[model samples]
Target chain A: MPQKHLVEIRDNPLFASIGAESFAALTRGAYVQNFPPHTELITEGEAADFLHIVSTGCVELFSIWQGRETSMSFQTENSTFILAATIKDLPYLMSARTITKSRVIMIPSQDIRGVFERDSMFAKSIVSELATCYRNAIKTAKNIKLRTSLERLANYILKLHLAQGGRIELELAVEKRRIASFLGMTPENLSRSFAGLKSHGVEMDGQVIKVVDAAKLEEFAHPNALIDG
Target chain B: MPQKHLVEIRDNPLFASIGAESFAALTRGAYVQNFPPHTELITEGEAADFLHIVSTGCVELFSIWQGRETSMSFQTENSTFILAATIKDLPYLMSARTITKSRVIMIPSQDIRGVFERDSMFAKSIVSELATCYRNAIKTAKNIKLRTSLERLANYILKLHLAQGGRIELELAVEKRRIASFLGMTPENLSRSFAGLKSHGVEMDGQVIKVVDAAKLEEFAHPNALIDG
Candidate 1:
């Protein structure tokens, strides 16, 4: 059915230790799907029927309340999304939509449960992945609750620089508005915050950012106050 | 060994469909210990060595930043803490301390790894629990970032009340200062906020609170606007 998606589950460490036969069974039940940019893949409060693996492009995970939306996370290549809801068969707490044209592999949740029932290694991997996710989310929450909006933006910029090998030159992966939402700030405030960071040796043009003084930026960001654990 | 503390493992629903025998073997190597209030059961950034099960008393989980402390969660009777860090054998992101005289069963991380290696059902349970913890943490994060300080305190009180069957005769398990920190506000702000709530039909004496007008408080809380999912 639809060229069977050539499941690359083996690349995922969660299934790396599982027996090849079980992996084959998982692949047999999986299929590939492609969506255009801005396509809503998973909606909040909807039943989770499949575990999604992003093979290309970017996806944003976000939640909405009272007609207002906030970005929770951004998922990119080689990452899986919605595992928690899929595993529990619970309604999603956040919606996921493609930010760019994307390729994804879809694995039925029932098959995932079947594999977990039969494969200890696979199950262990799932547990480890979930734990790592939980730890990261806790860190994000701490950052949001303990730090001010400007602090969040500063730290987020530093993180992106570090993630991009200690430099930010090209256009950013997402818009300032999306990034502002991700940092829990209003877009106007984010623009003003960027202006505030200019005195701290930060510069941006369109989507491109440059940290002119890394040390000064760190001082302004309060590196010691930023969560590393 | 400290009167043996009776370290029996049960197949709690949180652990999925794992059988009692599997749980027994998983905990066969576990050890039990008792500690006085304020004991630091686990510290942030330390290597996770054991999965702790709280059998008696409450434990407060918190993180510190720039010398300011914020409460992450509180674990009470019949609950497990830190499964996420324990499963991955990663450093803990937060520190945990006993709030009252307590007993805890510590299962060595090595034994847990062995159990995962040998038991599929137990592994599934671990994944399920981790997933639940992750989702709960996400919900908490959404609650904090998307709501105002006053709304947060209102929902916090309402949630506690609901957890106690929509009545507030019971004492708050935490101090007002700790509650303020947990709600990401100062003690002074919390005091002022509580006073403001009196006009909205909320009455409190020390830790005991009574919502004289549930509908009015809910209206003030704007639960639908505050919750993400």
Candidate 2:
């Protein structure tokens, strides 16, 4: 029987589609390791020698230029990170670090590359995952290009709310600073954006938020699934 | 014999690496057609039944939200667009339109999917291409999150200059307004950005641009291959 986390990972659609032999081949040498919060799992420009799966907690992908850093994305439980790097055997373009104490599965890159060549289903899974990743990224690029930070914050908060079945009250997922960076705005700008949105149906106290008027918020956000969802 | 554009596309490394039989199967029903500038080729929310490869001139991918539109990406010769949608059999999130009189080859989506499973080399090629696309999108996201519109414009101009082998003066590839959208800025901001860049060794005349001081421009742009390239 697989360990609890392993069982969860086995259920992941990204790897579940593979045959038993290929999945076994991939996980034969794979090991689960617990990491402390803020642990650096992979550094940008470093050789990618392993494929990492976040079995629990969260991991962030970020990049640095001229000593300035920006968070690119976050991956939570049961998702694989850096499949592209492992498949291409290329240097990681973004560094990944644990946002919280996390359990991660590490599969050697060689194992994956070897099995991918021999396993057609596994190859298809990789292709499908990559296709999804590519589409998500394009959508994100659209989100960044098409909307102002205010609109982005509204849609993001609305997305968060919807993900939890549209409860009126919710908690912010990441720190306001991180959220500000993720939305491509300054902390001050984010604060003002939130304040500007009060008339449009949002109320917040620290990290706690309330969607006082969902329809009004939606109207203000002008949310479009093509870009936001 | 392959037509002139087909000859060029046959040299495309994306398909060239696949086995000859897979390549032939892919191209058996592939046909290249030219369109007048501004022709809409692929509309968002439509079934992705064909994979489009740009053989000549230019095309842009863009999205609309509440009647507002922003350009997402531009594809030129020897490049494929909408691979993600075609591979995943999903609706396109972005619409594609010709920016110039362009030739594009359309391959029936079913043929590509059928060939992908049977031809491992072609499957690998698709994986590689998708991986590249994913990485590029991550880089683009980083660029948007990390830089201000002015910095982005400086880097954009430098990238254009370098792409043309560091030619002192290079014409803008797209209209200023469209370039502004692609860079996540307003046309007014782009004009002001050009004015700001004058101090950083950039000169502009209509669509014609001159990088008068290459080192100065590079210093300002801070071009990073991980993001800009």
Candidate 3:
């Protein structure tokens, strides 16, 4: 691995607190690779052999059932995928594919479990990281169950709006189709939802979204920290 | 806490492997209480002061947004609720209510974190428990996003049937309204979905559900371990 990639991987909170020895051991057999856009990195139902962290660009975590697929989440830079599966040594519950040409770090699950057992700091960090993941999943479920598709899309845009420092004009990171799937709607429904948001002062043109009135959008979305975060 | 409650709490996989001293420290400040049906145990967005364990009966973990409420999960005996929030000292994401007359054990969050720091085994157990929670949430997302109301109800009934040792006649412990909410459908939709399942050989009478044709139900439900587990 390059010095820069090592630094970026180390910056991840999951690896930040580990002892130097454990960190070295974790990275010893680890390898970094660049994936082309649309590359399938891992598939659901397969053994979680490697713990994957996106170094740059994007990776979409998705699932398929009865010939239908839906986007679970998208992992960008520094985001880890399937830590719970790697920790539990279970089958991957969601598949991963690179949405853009990306760099990713793959560490052996054995090394992860080995360090988790021998290093208390690493173990504690795993607890915190896993807790965060669990909470996020619960939040996702709540967002889906408690809100309509329009509300989901509205809050999703508000989330991106907030994430981008409340810019009046923001570009969506993921494609509309993937965003639609993540928000549990069809592409057609997403288009319709975006049209519906026009009344709330959101205007869209392809990938670019312009928040015409932030106050109106916020009032309409009612983005709650507990659900949105 | 009573000796029985202490033993049951210890039996939880999260606490099963901790040292006696750590276990004693955890239970020292803990207390067990019984709640009547429909009792609200914890509200969403409140500080997670206690790590709750359902010692007896059922507790429904649900969330409310605006005026709509949805069931997240129904935790039963030996199941822990909101461990991630308790460990992280964050607000509860979902409010829990007793669906049946219930006995619950409450362990203080401070003690949980204290013992977590001192006990490596306990920390590792927390990793496993949290991982399980995370994966369950993903499965739930897939179930909601990928399956329709009828499919969800079919699989849910199939799950209950399997849990009852493949019994031909299985009783739904929860009411139809709650099951409908949990499956992300309206009560009218739930009734319609149940009616839709009649072609697959299922019969419903109040809370009693009879799997008239197990083979047909399984073929229709197609319960996959990766998604259903």
Which of the numbered candidates is closest to the native, going by highest DockQ?
Answer: 3
Q: Which residue runs of candidate 3 sit more than 4 Å off their true CA positions?
A: none
Question: In CAPRI terms, where does candidate 3 land?
Answer: high
Query: Taking the tens digit of each residue's C-alpha lDDT, what string does model 3 give over A111-207?
Result: 9999998999999989999999989989999998888999998898888888999998898887899999999999999999999999998999889
Query: What stretches of model 2 exceed 4 Å from their correct place?
Result: B1-6
Each model's RMSD to truth, in Å?
A: 2.7, 2.2, 0.9
- List, residue by residue over A1-229, the lDDT tens digit for candidate 1: 3433444557777777889788877878888889999999988888888888988889999998666688999999878988888888888888899998999888888888788778777777788889878988998988887788888888887777777787646468887888899889999999999999998878989988888887888887875422733
- In the range B73-113, model 3's lDDT, one tens digit per residue, is 99988999999999999999999999999999999999999
Give candidate 3's error at residue B125 in angstroms: 0.7
Clash count, predicted structure 3: 0
Question: In DockQ, how does model 3 score against the reference complex?
Answer: 0.91
Best by TM-score: 3
TM-score of each: 0.91, 0.93, 0.99
Per-prediction fnat values?
Answer: 0.75, 0.83, 0.91
Output the lDDT of residue A130, model 2: 94
Cα shift from native, residue B44, model 3 (Å)? 0.1
Q: What's the number of clashes in each of the models?
A: 0, 0, 0
- For candidate 1, the clash count comes to 0
lDDT of 2 at B48: 92
What value does the lDDT take at residue A161 in candidate 3? 88
What DockQ, between 0 and 1, does each candidate earn?
A: 0.65, 0.74, 0.91
